[model samples]
Target: MHSILESVKESPGFTTGLRLSDDDLVLVKNAISEHLANHLARIEPDKVPLLQTTALDMYHTIAGQLPHDKLLTRQSRILAQTAVDAIRTTSLFRQLESQLGAFEISDEENVGRESISIRLVRPGFDTDVGSLHADDWFWKLYDFPVPTGKRRVKIWIAICCEQGKSGLILCPNSHKRDWDYSVIERAGMSKPLLSPDENPDKQIFQSKPGDAVVFNYDLLHGGMVTRGERTRVSMEFTMLIPEDVYQH
Candidate 1:
């Protein structure tokens, strides 16, 4: 895999960064565990410890770890915010700040931040999770206009995911084209934007705790069903170029 800087410079849509330090992972994992524990205080107790282990178990434990359980309600929101806060303090983010101009963490006011979402993909269980897609498609569905001048980026962190199995896949250099504009209504709503027969510039790689991938908001990407017993748990938030930074 190319260094994060090289990948971004080559395509700017997808780049995986250096491994997140043990300290960084600890801060994020603990925060998520505490918040989820608070939310689960009344529903389930045994599953609280599972949150620290892997995302698949956390979702399954809370939802009963059943094939039928698909509800990821309030706890998903908590995970998203907890992730956003933790990622903001990372050295990767610090590097992004210098490259993309100063950024504000996702908040209610920032249209970009509102798109933040938590993702948990489990093997043999597919229901409410995401499919092949880009963030801007849904943003436009809600009538949010894509930024015209300043660049916008998405920050993704894998809390309990690894290489292979059910990890995210991306169609590289897919963001720079105009074809999606006309077909987004039909194609952008689902996962795997292209068929295996289509021969796209597909890319997949391994990731570990604290690993992050920052890409253009317009890139075509989504998770795959894991092949292993472990589940893929991750969170992503949006970053917008600061107006002042562009002004200078």
Candidate 2:
């Protein structure tokens, strides 16, 4: 087996053994739950707990009704701060930086915060999650500028998921190659989704709330834990690892 850093350097990315503390996990859960509740047009006092119990249903009930971009929330939501703090210390990141020296993290909004977003995937609903594509495509879609001279590693947390059932589905090794694209229907509209030139194998990595996955930004990844009985909620962020090899 490859070491964590070695795996990240050589493959699609590492899928296991990275995590946050139990107490910190709770902080993350509560923070996102509150954020979801506040985004509702009008707070439904009774159904709010569904944010934790069945977020897919909550999205179907509330966020699902809003513009898709509204659902793709920014990290500025106040309650999200508590959640962000806890995620920053996920074991994999600490270890990565320890060996390579510290690097700046960016939310692309905050000067030094990781860019973060929470995702909800409803079972059997293809529109709830996005089509498979590399993260950098979004930068081009929105004309967002990526910082220069930094290597980006994407981080995904299974905030609410079932082990061996629901998690991340990836196109292995796509990060090292360029893939073609075509328009496809997603979220009720035509979107340019990545379609590999050749049929690719799908690799689904199973994970639970405590676990996290880190991968190359160019890797094709999407869809969610869609095999489970309930909705799956997950968080993703990017760490801007410094490329300066000679000095920290």
TM agreement with the true structure for every prediction: 0.71, 0.76
Candidate models: Cα lDDT each: 0.58, 0.64
Best by lDDT: 2
Q: Give the lDDT of residue 77 in candidate 2.
A: 38
- Scored by lDDT, model 2 comes in at 0.64
Candidate 2 per-residue C-alpha lDDT over 1-248 given as tens digits, one digit per residue, 9 for 90 to 100:
23544556667555456776677667677777766766643444454455446454245445454543553444333235555666556565576566556765556555354556777776676656776888877665656566788877677888777776667887777777777887666546546677656566678777777688777777788776476666677777777766663123
lDDT of 1: 0.58
Superposed by TM-score, candidate 1 places the C-alpha of residue 25 at a distance from the truth, in angstroms, of 0.7
lDDT of 1 by residue, 49-112 (tens): 5544545434554454422222345224434454566656867666666665566544432433
Q: TM-score winner among the candidates? A: 2
